[model samples]
Target chain A: MATMMNSTVFGTVVPHKNPTILRPLPCSLEELFCGKVKNYTHEKKIYDSSGKTFTVHKSTLQIYLKPGWKAGTKITFPKEGDVIPNIEPADLEIVIEEEPHPLFMRENNNLILRKNISLLQALVGFSFSVPYLDGSEFAVDVESLTFPLTPKVVQGKGYLSQRDGSAGNLVIFFNILWPKVLTEEQKSILKKGPLSECEYLGLL
Target chain B: MATMMNSTVFGTVVPHKNPTILRPLPCSLEELFCGKVKNYTHEKKIYDSSGKTFTVHKSTLQIYLKPGWKAGTKITFPKEGDVIPNIEPADLEIVIEEEPHPLFMRENNNLILRKNISLLQALVGFSFSVPYLDGSEFAVDVESLTFPLTPKVVQGKGYLSQRDGSAGNLVIFFNILWPKVLTEEQKSILKKGPLSECEYLGLL
Candidate 1:
């Protein structure tokens, strides 16, 4: 067994008794350089991930990266008007864990250090019945089905209706965490459950 | 005069330009009971305000509403379990105003609305930010800011933060949108012309 104690990605050890909300891991350490690493310095706001309980802001932080830059050691800042796509917020699961992820060696003679994780882990999605422009409400699912990149960012444009003549490529960040997996049959029950199965039903 | 448009609430004539991000008016009948609503009820999906995008899974939705309970109303529900107070994502903006809100309302049945509106109006506040033990995330925000109600909802126990040891009320819902009146010293710089003042450069 993996010894599923309350452990987090950042190597923080949370008490087994109390589970913590995990924060979405950023795309990469180099990516967190909100501005040019050269012009703008970096600062880390350390919190006692286990002891202190803080709420994460729901707003998406738009990162502006410099031009002509690729992911490598030579990190650069985003230039003005440069749009850094954010990870999906709905796909993110913020939590405080008991222990950080263990470090492992790669085939290349490099080491992978442990840190706080913020990104989509397995999957996340939601279902709701919202009113449409045609004057009737319908039940539909909004699944953060795929990612633009592995170790996904917290904000990214996900799937939308192609038939609707609205903005085709709408960008949004997922901030919700994934739910516990159920048997395939249980999931089917949820999908085909009675109209009154859900408790916190809200019309959008 | 501003372009004439079919107002959503109250069915009055109004100006058209940009959609308001927040408001106090209730969602219009056209928006509340659309064809999409039925599809989501039967299919268990969520339709965005644009009536275009939707998700498919229902497991995540079940976990998101774990602590909530259904009211006597068929579709309405409330939070019941852990007080995870945060803004709801579906209700991104709280209210939509078809007419501009005047600085002051006249007494009696006659109401004086604001004019020369640049966009539609709505008010919104962060509802809750809860983390599932399983790893999903959900946020709720309304379109309109209805005085103390929205703020109170934001400050409630189960909406945003899971819980902190500190007992005293925390300042989570600070008003960032209060129009900042120009200070005497700051106004003096603008009067001196944009590039004329050296101090303004540092401030920017």
Candidate 2:
């Protein structure tokens, strides 16, 4: 269960002024936080930085910090599933404006890390995200699918041949083998997984 | 760590004379199996069916089962990163294409278990891997970052209404904020922390 994953802040979060309680809202919990709000009958109350917490039955609230909300500020939110029993806390999780993976980052300063790795190996983490291609939203197990073995760089050859007096180039070639098709339901899951809270499927 | 996962297999996996182990390889061990190979370098040798065990050396082996390497023909490979003692069985892991996740496969049907679980949560019991994305990849601690007051899902309501009502959507979103970048050495550690066999800079 120990995994190191890279993520970014979506917005600025601050400390809560008053002790507060989180209640499960009506409708689907996943729907409430999928990075997009659709339809809901009730409003949820969020504590402000001024140190006051109150029950407000509104779908949305304008959040303010005593100091203020600043872009690029770091904050954290506690997971909804756990709440300390009879304890006062300002339990918080950090936030960031989630940007696309650095692989697709505007600038590829990543070359520093790619130093001696084979082009194939350097790009191993680059997932085609089969779901991304179908215009569907389901998560694809990139690990489960097959990749074509098109080895371009000869083994034992350094990526930079000219630097060490050998046939070297800064590239590794490999091809991704795409799956024929995925179910509509699977597609939807991929598209929405990163944007919303996942709901519990009775099957699980 | 506790994980929610399930799988069941009904039929038996028939072994193949030759099984190719794909490589050039990705950052993760799992990618090698799912990838294709041009020249075969290993033959399939099943050690256990229920345990999904097998071995491959240097040979042209096809992963497809049945006539070539089809479903229903269960094959076995080593658990990821598994190695033998001085025996030095081989430097690489083997892949048996016929083998399927026990829980995900029921008889002839591939079960669609719940999706959208965080990568960390999903990695609990099974031994699988993916390419390593070097960045801040932890979901548990956000001591150095701040979060936004309003969660990101505020814009998803309209989209959900249009989707078919059979299944709901799920999204896993996180925000991360960093005040500054670490030294190049620190960046390398973060990307390979969980899997690296070396001591961290602090430890040394």
What lDDT tens digits, residue by residue, belong to model 2 across residues B1-204? 111233334664332222223333111212122333423344434343333444543455344322122232233343222223212122333333433432222121212221223222221211222121121222332211112221222122111121332222222233211112233343343344331222222120
Task: Please give the CA lDDT of all the candidate structures.
Answer: 0.26, 0.27
- Report RMSD (Å) for each prediction in the order shown: 33.9, 30.2
Q: Write the per-residue lDDT of candidate 1 for residues B72-163, one digit (tens) a residue.
A: 11232232111111212222122222222222121121222221110011111234443321245446444332231123232332212124
TM-score of each: 0.12, 0.14
| Docking class for candidate 1 | incorrect
Tell me, by TM-score, which candidate is best.
2
DockQ each candidate and list the results. Answer: 0.01, 0.01
For candidate 2, the lDDT comes to 0.27
The DockQ value obtained for model 2 is 0.01
Give per-residue CA lDDT, model 2, range A1-204, as digits (tens). 111233335663432233333332222211211223223233334444432543454432222221111124343344321222222243333232323332211111111111122212222233333121113443322222122243332222221122343322212234322222334443344334321232222213
Model 2 Cα shift for residue B85 (angstroms): 27
Error of 1 at B52 (Å): 86
Q: What is the TM-score of chain B alone in each candidate?
A: 0.17, 0.18
Lowest summed-lDDT stretch of 10 residues in model 2 chain B? B153-162
